[model samples]
Target: MTTNAELAARFEEFADLLEADDVEYKPRAYRRAAENILAHPVPIAEAVESGDEDAIDDIEGVGDAISSKIVEYVETGKIEELEELRAELPVDIADLTRVEGVGPKTVGVLYRELGIETLDDLEAAAEAGEIQEVKGFGAKTEQNILENIDFARTVGQRHLVGEARPLADDVLAYLEGIAGVERCEVAGSIRRWRETIGDVDVLAATDEPDAVVDDFLAWDSIDDEIESGPAKASVRVGEMRVDLRLVVPGEFGSALQYFTGSKGHNVRLRNYAIDRGMKLNEYGAFDVSELEADPDADPQHVGGGQRVGERVAGETEESMYDALGLPWIPPEIREDRGEIDAAEAGALPDLVTEADVRGDLHTHTEWSDGNNSIEEMVAAAENRGYEYYGVADHAQGPGVVGGMGLSEAEILDQVDEIRAIDDEYDVHVFAGIEANVDAEGAIGLSDEVVDALDLIVASPHSALDQDAETAGERLIRAIENPAIDVLGHPSGRLLNEREGLAIDAGALGEAAAANDTALEVNANPRRLDLWGSAVQAAIDEEAKIAIDTDAHRPATLEFVRWGVHTARRGWAEPNDVVNTWELPDLESFLH
Candidate 1:
């Protein structure tokens, strides 16, 4: 299958080739094809297997030539032209392209001129002042290359969600506060809540592009300025480069549509537009004929164009969708994941909202590894206007052998302690234990101890070293226990650290649904376990989800924002989320 990452990488490589070769128009075509393929809802290989070359042809920006390339790649697992291009410039295209201010042309030039095959070699050459000896390469360019090499190495390969997410939030908040900004969104892979990020891309709708660009360039946190233009600006915020683009209100939807993509999604949408005799661009959708309007026409800041097949019509994202005969796709589901089919069938799920979360079902306290006191945790939940808060501290038995988990006696004591603190807040607080699931699929907490707690969360804390089938069976049995209310952080993943337990989430989700147990989409950026895909699977089985912060501190409780984003990414809706249910309704589900 032409995965989103594979397609995006190919298209970007093509773009770099175009720049290196200084090929005009053709690069955009390839990029557009890449974008559409990235956003395509179904697997491209499936579409290819169906012998529907029109599937490739339908993407906007993909003319017959690009379509033929796609067909060729799918048919033979190789693209002839791309292969030839690779043969001509056989260096690691992506690695070389990663250098700051360096593109394909520079890579080719350096590779050909100095035999610079590696970053080490490039650095050595720069230090020896050999790079400046090459045409078009100046001292400044050499210095920039050296500076970027360290940045590239330090950034490693991937930016953790925990680290990149805050930076994104800071940028989004700054953008939102700016004047003339109507709607703002963080686009690209970041928006998809992908595990890692390379660069951050933001798109905003503003009436004044000039003012918006000025404000963006002046952002206080920005360490360096890259480029600022009418439609787009790039800046280096710390080590991460942030790109911001402005679009008018009319073009907001289309621009958002174009920018908030997996690239494949955009290509697919573009194709859809083409099939409908319309043209889709970053600005908006236009009748294919309207795009032919004076090639020398001045680029305006307006949103969309008016005119559909010679008859003048409206221009707007809503109208664009109407023109295309489909509905607007939510940005989260824009990864080309069955969204088009949902749009065609009008079967998109009513996604869950923050308001639906009436209570927080999983949280920690100072008694365990949590940094916050029980009172503080409850108070924070009350501050958020939650009706109830479940305090599921770690139980000291089973797999929680060495951690801050409480002993069975300690748990019984905490229940009474929790009851004692209950009168201090208006919100009801339930005492629970996050019991470990042993290798045999039995919870560490005794039945008597489990029965005493208001909420019980079963999770795998030890034997994470188990195989997929063992781990899956272990969780299934644990989840099947009527005493368990929610399955916590199913995968146990730690950002950039642990990979957690391996299991078939589909089977676990079915077991959870059968047992009427909710699955936890751990809100911690590091572990967003029961990730979007897993959550989607759970939802498909008619199982409910609990979007919990799994907070260790009061501040960490705010990790709920990321958790909510996780659920949203999974296409979870109010009804599908257990926390969204009212306290009484939720309590009823407790066995």
Candidate 2:
């Protein structure tokens, strides 16, 4: 079994090795193939295993040579060309590249200059002051490497939900196609849409457990089989480990409940069951107090008791909870964090959903760092049937020195272009700027520039390492700005890269509430910035929230769901999100 992720990594390495060796066109081809493979809906290995050369070649950006290599890897778990390239470069490309400013070129240069192959070697060279001695490497570059290496080391191996979700969907699609498979679904933290996931868990209901297990083991994307049994199998695919379990149709509901757990939630649920003299386990909910069972027996064994009492529920999760006299709880809030109590009181908040979002308030176009032009981005929004779309390109400021942000003149010119586009489309196009908030919480742009825009998303770009109190005060000052409508990616954290800022979230939320500024949940997977807990704190203070994608491209606008769900995790309802409101209503609120 060879997963798309593993194959893509090999191709990426091939590209890196080629670049280090200065092999031109082939490297681009390899990189393109790798990107396409990762984004492919199904596992690349599956097409290869199907012996369908046409299907393999049909993958976007994949040519005959790459397809052949993919087939070779799937069949033999190795690619000779990649192996040769690895032997030639023999550098820790991935680890080195994780450092903030390091890239393949840097890696090649450092390796050629000082034989640096690992982070330890890089760190030692930097500490010894030897790296600055190399041509093209300066003292500052060396210092940055030293400073960021520790942050890189702390970066975990967990995959973001954005990355893991498609893989899970692919697995589910594959399982559903198997004969005798009655139902299949992904479980665990994935179901709850946790920002990062350790691995993927899937459950299926079928009488043919053996057949299901065999089919799963033979999945085209499997890199290696970890373990396989009659009812369960775990396999490694790409960079993710996928575990599958099979249960009888009658027990499917109970199994889903047991497996889709935040352990704390299940523990509390078991306690609730006991209080009602009911036994709840993977098999089903049963009235077991009347039956004789040893109190001193192991808990695992206790759950294995005979189905002696009434079979209250087993076929559905709702029924399982209904039998316990509790409403079915949504998985996202099942962390035993007052969800049970809320369910008891019939007070669960109606979570905001993707459908509730009427617009995206923070996006970019060619005017800034985004790839698409203004017309393209607005067209994309109109296609999504949005009532409004905010074009908030980066404003020239502290962290935007690289010509990535618009000058005042450029911003003014773009406003005219946006107004022109707005006249043509059904969607109300908002001309806005994502202005930088400096150390003292002053917006980077002038009053005239801010006044010209329909919206403003002020964000902290530099000086992200401030102490908690300073950070909180800084954000509060930004929120207090009358021109600012939203605070974007408040923490400025990238998932596993930088820690961003440490702030008192409650205080920040309170200040935002007072100032009528909405706090944003930046939905870009890398920065789900005002994460769930922070969102909760903000909601507690009745602060308005805006679930914006911070999208730079049209395809990425769909990322709104990530922000919407993150808001839900924070206990936000539709009314809490300004983007969920009608256009006239939202405009009034913004003013």
Candidate 3:
């Protein structure tokens, strides 16, 4: 069976190939269609299998042409047009594009000029100095590719949480509906909302483990069963690996807690328990003060042997932590980084929730590369009951793609349009611009352009290969620019795509705090820049943060939740995020 991920991947490849062929318009169309399909709540393949041809129409960006392709792949496991494209330009577009400076156009050039088709081929051509022989290719560009080839090859093994979570949700929903399964939930780093996931780990509570395992093995979305047993199973669903573990209902909570761990957290907690003459493990917390414990036991195993003493708690996760005389630590903050100590001192933060955000400060529309219009994107924000929304389209500067930025005249016209719509609905629409920060940390927006907007989100778009000190200084200078309201995607990194820049988070935080600029936790999964650890550093400096989605369309507007979770992982509270404040407070911060 084709999972949503599998179906979406085909279209992504379709888009890449189309872009490489220099096909205009259709590539963006295919990419948007692919995005909608990937984010669709249900499995489109299963809907097609059920003979619902209209399933494709239900997806927002998909139209007749893309719909037929979806149906074809679902029915026959092949897209004929995609196959033809592959035959025409037989290069590994995905792998080649993974290199830092390489893109679809680069792939096309290399494949045509140097007959490079794979990472090995690209590497060979670069090593033999054949790449530089091609026009438009230089020593620096070839060296850049050679440097990034191996890194790109190694990073593909992991999946992004944005891609894997939907699959995990589908799996959990499926297992919950199966007979004899009482409770089901996701586990592992996915549970912690980590940016990248190794695999989806799920746990099931059941009285009949064998029955539940059998039903899970029969899941229609599964592509291959890696292994199976009465209470455990592993399966391959598309490119993601899923491991399911079953425990009796009596130990469900403990099992959930055990599986949802950052190894450091579990180890720290177990040692804390040991210091108290107690034991903690997957089986549950135990009061083993009176029992003989072995010091020579394997240090790698938590509590050594499971169920070794009088079981204090196992039925509920809260109880397990209660047994340790501490409050339950949130999974996001359970990365050992002083969380156990914080819990002991009753100093755990009240992490910000998704509902707390009042608006998104950085977003896009048809004025830039975004698919939607400003009116349409604003409608989406109002639909979510946002008190305010910011329309920050791209401004022409360095790294602004293909003149997809607003000129000064365009900025003035957009401000007029935004003012006309500010109170048109129940929301406040703030006119904004996402200005590109140049190599020397200058935002190219003129005084007239900056004065015309209510917000400015300055972001680094190019020169991402600077040393740590250079990057930190560049970002600090940008942050100090009085006209800039938010610093966007601090590192500019794209998960599994590129290691964008090397930034010192602590120094950036200091600069941002001193300048009263809010650091952005860009919610876009591929670029969750100012990731958890960085956010924490910013928080330590008492610098404000904005959990903006950097949304390019309506569907992506909801990606703010990913940002909220990343902030939680950073120990951020409602007060730390400017958008989480009331409308008046947010407006004051903007001013």
Candidate 4:
């Protein structure tokens, strides 16, 4: 089956190839279509299998041309046009363009001038000092490629949480529906809500392991069954690898604990158990000191003795931790970074949750690159029962691609529209701009335009390659701008695609704290900037935090959950986030 993710990747590659070949307009069109398709509620394969071409075409950014191509790929498992373009370019555009400083145009230039078609070829050219010989590529450019190539290679393996999550949910639902399955839950990093995941791990409690395994193998979503046994099965679903383990009801809790681990956390728990004359393993937590030690016995046995000793705790995760004299720690904070001590001391924070957020402060509309209109976005926020909604469209400036940012005049016009819309609904609609902060730390909008707004979300959209000292200073300047309310997506990193700017978070947080500006946890899964550690540093400095979706469309507003959990991981409470306040209080804080 052609998953939406797979289809999106194809269209994105088509865009890159088109841009590389100097083709005009089509690249952006293809890229937009790709983005919409990925976000579409329905699966592309299901729509294609229904033979409903209009259903595919109805996707926000897709048109007849892209729709036809999608159908072709769905029916034949290939698109001839894309294949032709790949043959023509004959370059690994995706891999090469992933380097921080490289884009499709640079990839094309390197390919045309030096026949650099792959990372290996690019590396060899950079090493041999050949890339510098190319016309526009200088010695510095060559050196940067060599430095970033290694990072890019390692990034390609992980899938963004947003992309892998839907498939995981589907698999869980499918397994839960099967008879004889007693309990099921997702384990591993997904359970911990990591920003990115390598694969999905599911654990099920069932008396009939053989029946459960057979049911899993027969799942329609399975593209390939990699391995199968009475108790476990591994399958490939779209671009994700899913591993399922069926354990007896008795050991479900212990198995979950063992599987949902950050290796280091488990090691700490094991040592703690050993100190108490107990043994902890996947099967259960058992007291093993009374049993005689048998050095020659098979270590695979649960407790390394014929008598497994007194059973202490194993039926529930809470009990397992209770047996160890600690509170049940939230999975998000299970990074072994003082969480165990906090649990033991009964000082674990009451973490922020999805329900605690009052509204979204950073969102876009058709005035910028967003698919939905201002009215539509506000309605979506209202649907979520938010106390307030901020419409922060991109302000016209450098790095604002495809003329997606609003001009000074357009921004003023949007304010009127927002005000009129505000009167029509219960939700307070605050008109604002996601103004670009230049390298020198100046916002793009004029003082008058910025002052007239209810909120101002200043973000660094360009000069992302600056070093730590420079980036820190650049962000500090933006924070100091009196008109700025929130420093959006502070680092500008795009998950695996780009490393973005490097800065000292503690210093940046201090500057933000001093300036009375809030730093954003931009919850667009791919760009969960001010990631856990950075969020913690900001919190330590007493700087305010805002968890906004940076939503480009109505449906995207739900991404706030990702931001909320990320804040929780950083020990941020409801009081720490400005958006968690009521409308009047939030407005007062902004003022």
Candidate 5:
């Protein structure tokens, strides 16, 4: 089964190969095929296994030839055409093109001109002044390549939604508060609530574009300036690229709609407009060629590029949806996850709200891995006006191998301290333990210790090597334990770095619901496991969800916004999420 990400990459590689050969039309075909593959609702393998090429054709933008290739790959576990193309080029393509700004043409040129086949070889050529000798290659390009090569080497592939999300929020809040800015939003993949991000893109409608761009460039946290134009600016905030675009109010919504794209989604929406006798573009819908309402015309060309629908007001996102006769689509659902279908069907979920959240369930104190003391953690929750908080510290068995965990005795000893301090706070603070689940599918803490706590968060911290079936069963057994209140970070994955344990999320979700155990959407930014898709599966199973920061410090508690965003992306509604329950309901659920 090729994951959407993997399939997308393969298509991109094919497109790049075509570009290297200067092949026309084929690149667009492959790119379109890739888009459809990523947007597919079910596994491509399933559709192909049944010998149904219609499944491929059913996907928007996928044609017969591409579908045939997909079927070929599915039937034979190989793409002969792609393999042939790769063999022909055979120039360490993936590696050489990975250099930022170096595309397939540049790779072809470098290989032909300098015989540079690897990163080290490229570095050697650049150092020896060999690259500038090639046509269309200059000193600036070589320097840029060298400067970004280290970045390309050291930089992680993509940032998880958890990690990229916070920085975006901080930047948005700052920009939104600016005096002349009318509306600010995150666009691109982030707006679509993608699982990973290459860069953080922000779009804003401002009365003062110059001032806004100036202020953005002057952001105190900016580590380096990449480029600055009149309407847009790019900066390197730590390792991530942050791009800010300023536009006039009249063009805001259209730009938002244009930029907040999965590309496939945009193409679909554009076709929808074309079918309705309207032309959709970055500026707004416009009158194009009118088809009909014509009795004699083909239905496919009825509205053929005509701009019949009303223009969205204010050029902002909300108005853009209104122009399309739909409500505003949230960022997460913009991935084409039946969002357009829901829009056309008029049955989209209301989605969860931050205000619906009543308490912070999973937290930590200095007794274990966290930085804040029990009292301080409680005080912070109280300051947030939370009705309650759950203090869950790490249990000893995972060991101090990471210098971030506690001993089982120390965890037990902290209960008395938690109880003693509980009396001083206005809100309820439930004592809990974040116990480790060993490789053999068993939690480290004894039932005696687990039962002693008000809540037990069982999580896999080691031996994340089991196959999907085995790991799913392991987690299902843990969820069935009457003593365990929650399953923590079901997949131990770390963003952009590790894949973590493999498990069948649908099965785990069913077990969670059946056993009356909740699943923790660990919102650590690095480990937003039980991601939006998994959260949706849990929702389907009637399982409860807790969005916890797993915060190790007081400042980190603010990460709840990311968790909330992720939950909303999963199409969670207020009632569907357990954290939305008030204190009494929470206690009943936990018990």
Candidate 6:
């Protein structure tokens, strides 16, 4: 079956091919349509096939031309126009473009100039020194291509956490409905809320392994069965892989601990256990101090062996940690980066969670590119039990989509609507704007416009290819502006799409701390900029953090969960994040 993602991917290809040909305006239109198609709540392919006109029309940004192509694709499993574009270009647009500093136009240039159609071709050209000889190409550019080509070639094709987590939820829901499944939870990088994950690892506790495996294989979402066994199964779900492991309820906790690992953390933890003369593994914690050395056997039951020594704990994760005289570590902090030491010292941070997020400071409405009205968004915040809410739609600035950002007059008008909404809704609404910071570190808004906003989130939208020192200076300048309350998505990154900038987090953090500006941890899964390591650096410098969803609509407000976990990954506590403050305190901070 053709999924929404598959349909969206087709449109993305159309956009890329169009851009490669230097067809200016249509490419952006197609890309916008592609985003809408990806975000649309229904199956577009099914709508085209079933002749559901209303469903097709309901998709935003899809003009008649795009819709006709969709119809053609649904009917014939191919778009004739796209095929023609592909044939004309005759290049691996996606893979070639994945190389850092390579774009669709560059792909066109490379193809027309040097006949570079594949990774191998590009590598051969670069190696033969043919690339630098081309007009507008330099030795440095060639070197960078050489540097990034390997990553683009060898980088694991990981699924976005935002996409994978929901699929895991669906799998969990299905497993919960089974006859004998006791408990089920996701493990691995997804469990730790990493930006991208290799696969969805699900652990289910069940005495009836064969029955559970049979039902898992029977799951409707499975696109292909990779492998199946009595206690475990691996299945292909769309582009992602799902691995299911069934264990007896007693071993569930230990198994989860072992599998939900950063690898380094588990290694350090095993060492800790060894130093204590205890053994820790997927099986359980055992007192091995009294046991004689068995040279032929595995000392660590990491691969599932039962009762290696006098078993001390295994039934619960808490018990597993308690057996080591340490508290259970949150998965986000399980990178072996002093978390175990912190645990042993009883100094582990009270990390921020989704519930700790009282409101989102960065969001949008119909006044900008967002789909909903200000009232609808406020109502959604009220539903979430927020003490206060903020709507900082995109302000007129560099990098904003044309006709999508608000002018000075429009910004003031929206503030009025937001004030009224604040009175009507239970949640106090703050009028805000996400102003654009240009390459030279100047804000787009005037003084009057900045004063009108209750909060100002200045973010870089253009010229993100600055050097580390230059990017840091630009960000520091943005934060130093008294009107700017938060620096949103500090790096302007779109995970797997682009590496936005090379930034000196420590320098930016120090400047932000001195300026009293909060560094935002953007929660949109794609732009979880100021990721764990960067956020940690900023927090270490005593900079305040703002965890925001950057939501476009009400339903997207829940994206804060991703942000919260990301903040947790940086060792953020409730007090470190402004939104977790009391309403009055947050107001004071923003002002």
RMSD of each: 19.8, 4.4, 1.9, 2.3, 19.2, 3.5
Candidate 5 weakest ten by summed lDDT: 300-309
User: Candidate 3: misplaced stretches above 4 Å?
Assistant: 299-304
Clash-forming residue pairs, model 6: none
Q: What is the lDDT of candidate 1?
A: 0.74
lDDT by residue for model 3 (44-157), tens: 887888888787687878888888888899888899999999999999888888889988888988888888899999999999989988999899888888888898998777
lDDT string for model 6 (1-591, tens) is 355656677888888888888888888778768767766655576677788877877776777888898888767768999999989999987778878778888888889999999988998898888999989998988877877777676533876687778678878988999998998999999998898898899999999999999988887667789999999999987667899999899988989999999899999998999788789888888988777766666666432355767889888888889999999999999987799999999999999888888888999888887878888888888899998888999888788965588889999888888877778877888999988989988886878877878999889988877888888888888888888899999998777667787887778889888988999999987788889888888889999999998887666787787889899999999999999999889888875
TM-score of each candidate?
0.67, 0.84, 0.96, 0.95, 0.67, 0.88
The global Cα lDDT (0 to 1) of model 3 is 0.88
Q: Cα lDDT of all candidates, in order?
A: 0.74, 0.84, 0.88, 0.87, 0.75, 0.84
Clashes of 6: 0
TM-score of 1: 0.67
The runs of at least 3 residues in candidate 1 whose Cα sits more than 4 Å from the true structure, single-residue gaps closed, are: 1-156, 173-184, 205-215, 228-230, 247-250, 289-316, 397-402
Superposed Cα deviation of residue 107, candidate 5 (Å): 30
Each model's backbone clash number: 24, 1, 0, 0, 8, 0
Residue lDDT tens for model 1, 219-330? 7566578988887899876457788988777667666666667787777776776666566666566665444434354222112354233322223446656667787676
Better of 1 and 3 by lDDT: 3
Give one digit per residue, the lDDT tens place, for model 2 in 547-571.
9988766767878867887888788
- For candidate 6, which ten residues in a row score worst on lDDT? 297-306
Best by lDDT: 3
Positional deviation of residue 412's Cα in model 3 after best superposition, in angstroms? 0.6
Best by TM-score: 3
